[model samples]
Target: MSTTNTDVLVVGAGPTGLLLAGDLATAGIDVTLVERRPHGLGNMTRAFGVHARTLEQLDARGLADELLATGTTLTTARLFGRLDLDLTRLPTRFNHLLVTPQYEVERLLERRAVDAGVTFRYGTELRGLRQDAEGVTAELTDPEGTPLTLRARYLVGTDGHRSSVRTALGLPFPGHSVIRSIVLADVRLAEEPADVFSVNGSGDTFAFLAPFGDGWYRVMGWTRTRQVADSEPVDLDEIREIARKALGTDYGMHDPRWISRFHSDERQAPAYRVGRAFLAGDAAHVHSPAGGQGMNTGLQDAANLSWKLTAALRGTAPDPEALLDSYQSERHPVGAMVLRSSGAIVRLAMAHTPLTRATRSLAAHLVNAIPPASARAMGMLSGIDIAYAPAPGTGRPSGRRAPDARLREGRLYELLRQGEFVLIAPGGPAPALPSTAPVTAKHLIRATWTDPAKRTAVLVRPDGYVHWTSN
Candidate 1:
């Protein structure tokens, strides 16, 4: 067996792995990405909604604008027929959800990664892995069933739910299926949906409709009266009937491009990091598709973990283990939150009993009528208000996301394209960052605020979160 080595071994070539690999390569880190499938993206998409925070993250990478051009935007998300989350009012440059196919995201990320020199091993599958204090060793089978070994300073599993990497690490994805025998239909609706995004449920069924541009629609339907195994052949008529029951119409859906049946589960790994190996994306957490958050959450996960891994491998981190451990500490809670929110939405949509039905209605009206409540819900749903706690013994306000603060030369996100920490000083020229700060000289970019703002200087992490605020 031939053995190869790299700084990072990224398992899976999906959106999460591609983004993470691209970020590392952009930072000049060596990355080797392994995928079980072939070298081309199949004409399918599992994720259709890209949240504002994800677009912002892509903006930092200089890819968001191009991606935005490939999709339609939904400014308002209507759920349960009454509750509406106004995405337009979100406090970010991208104030709407981009209804694009997941494959489009992968294409951009893969191109970036290739340009940055990421080594890709498509048609390769991970059989198992072993990690020690030094690094991780992956046992893989190549395109021709030839066994190979790969060594890396660190490993990340962005592979989906039945993750091989997580299994090798002995981590448990603990959760049960939330909905069974769900059907997905890709069709051209003769009549467009009234809302750009639509979701509703009656006692007997639930339906969600979102566009993928070009008059194409992705419709997901579930029927309480008929539950069967995933292998059961999907009847398009059955799906349309369920949609009509829940949504009051199927919008004249016909000529299905494709249709499939599957089940959705709400699960999260107990731990994200185990030794030198880590879990991310669906490998770490998964939930019902109520909020259209699956791919968006995975993209954010890649963004958060990418830089930390870079710092650790670059020898710029003050404490590599602690910095690496932060991946779990910072992201685990966010995963739990997603699980709870998505779970609540799906369960509410599936409400059948009189008590549950009333609770669902009241909850919808309450969130709908209250401004603050609506704001919070939108914030969480859009991935705009995720904040980390202050690190222990530190009062530096280190965990909140810094707004795209303006600078004399350009925007904050534009500066972040260099894959470095951004130091924003109050007006005038940015002062030289001191040696005392926790970043290496090569990994810090200096800029001056466009306006005379706070007296305290701010350090933004590579992932766009505040690292610290200094006087």
Candidate 2:
């Protein structure tokens, strides 16, 4: 047996875990990341689309260019039998959607975390944990199955749906089984599709298709019958058949790379935090993969919790516990909303009734006709609609997500790349921040003032939400 100590012990090296580890390490915290798998990127493409908000977060970390290079840019997301929503009109430099395989995302994040001095123990699994008032003691097993004990001030679970840390903590993950099983394949197509994204809601079966790269397309949809068991095996021929039926044409699916079937389940942990141990990403919340929000949401959760934990550990905040509670309070509602929205979308898109289909079509048409309403509706799917409630004693706008804007001297996101809390005052010098403060603070020159006399100052958290402000 061996013993080790660190400020934070993060379980799982997936997107959420890697992002959080990078954040903690960049903040100068001692972080150790453990993964059950060996030192190789997983081939499975669990998620592909990274939204605008997530791009802003990554840009703040100086990783936007690398990620953009690895993925293809998507400007339009069209609904079958309906108008296409041009994402370029959205208010960010990353107005377009980035379609990169999940493995690529993990690889980029892992490299960044390693460069930041994060200790990664691949092929090591978290066995159990016990938390006291002072810190958390975790039991881990090495690749050779050797036992060890590790201690940390905080333990974070970025593990997947079947999280050992969450199970050991006795947290309840209450949700229903996936009713519809859909096939996902990553393969090079002989012929490429014209549209970047296409949705087919004309038949009893609904299909969604998106082209990734190298002539590869991701096809997802539900069958008319719910007889397909979630765990049942799927094949390439069946997937091709579904694509043909949904697209109303036959396309060759000859060269297959990987094939798998997945069901969408909506589940969230009862509470994000239990004592000194906490949860983030899929370990904290799981929802249907509609609108491609699963990975983006998890990444954002890591971004939010990282800074708060850093502040607490560095003694910049009043109490670590105070900042910890905000995690549950702020994220729980967002998770619930995502679950509700995704579930509704699945139902509407997979509806079998003619009347329901007609109604949905009409609704889509009406929304697309009105540009403002259409933009707002599309924003929900893009994750730009999320807004955190204001902190106490801070008179700020509610339900408005933090916007990425340009400052007179530098880009707003450039300041955030340092992985520190940023204070953006859009007129002149920022308020007198604590000189010896633990958190990173910066002043910005505003190009245009929202309020000429107010001298608006917005304090953005690591997750890019406006946590504090002065008007």
Worst 10 residues of 2 by lDDT: 440-449
In candidate 1, stretches whose alpha carbon ends up further than 4 angstroms from where it belongs are 41-43, 393-396, 427-437
lDDT for each candidate structure:
0.89, 0.79
Q: Provide the lDDT at 197 for model 1.
A: 81
Model 2 lDDT per residue over 1-471, tens place:
899999999998999999999999987999999999888855585698888888878888888888988878899887655757889888778888888888878888989999999998999999899989889999999999999999999999999999999999999999986446877777666767776576775546767777775467777766775347768988877777777777765367667777778777889998999999889889988887777888988898898889889888877775557777888888888888888877766776776678877777887788788899778766877778778776655555632566776565467677677776667665655576433223543322223334455466666666667656564
For candidate 2, report its TM-score.
0.92
Candidate 2, residue 257: how far the Cα is off, in Å: 0.2
Best by the TM-score measure: 1
Q: What is the C-alpha lDDT profile of model 1 across 1-471, one tens digit per residue? A: 999999999999999999999999998999999999999849485578899999999999999999999989999999888999888889999999999888889999999999999999999999999878899999999999999999999999999999999999988889999889889988888897777587798857999999988788899999988899999999779888998899888889999888889999999999999989988899999998889888888888999899989888878877878888888999999999999999899899889999999999999899999999999999999899999976554455878988998788699999999888998887766555434344876777888876665667888889899877775
Extract clashing residue pairs from model 1. Answer: none
Error of 2 at 245 (Å): 1.3
**What is the alpha-carbon lDDT of model 2 when measured against the actual structure?**
0.79
Clashing pairs in 2: 60-417
Runs of candidate 2 with Cα error greater than 4 angstroms are 398-400, 426-454
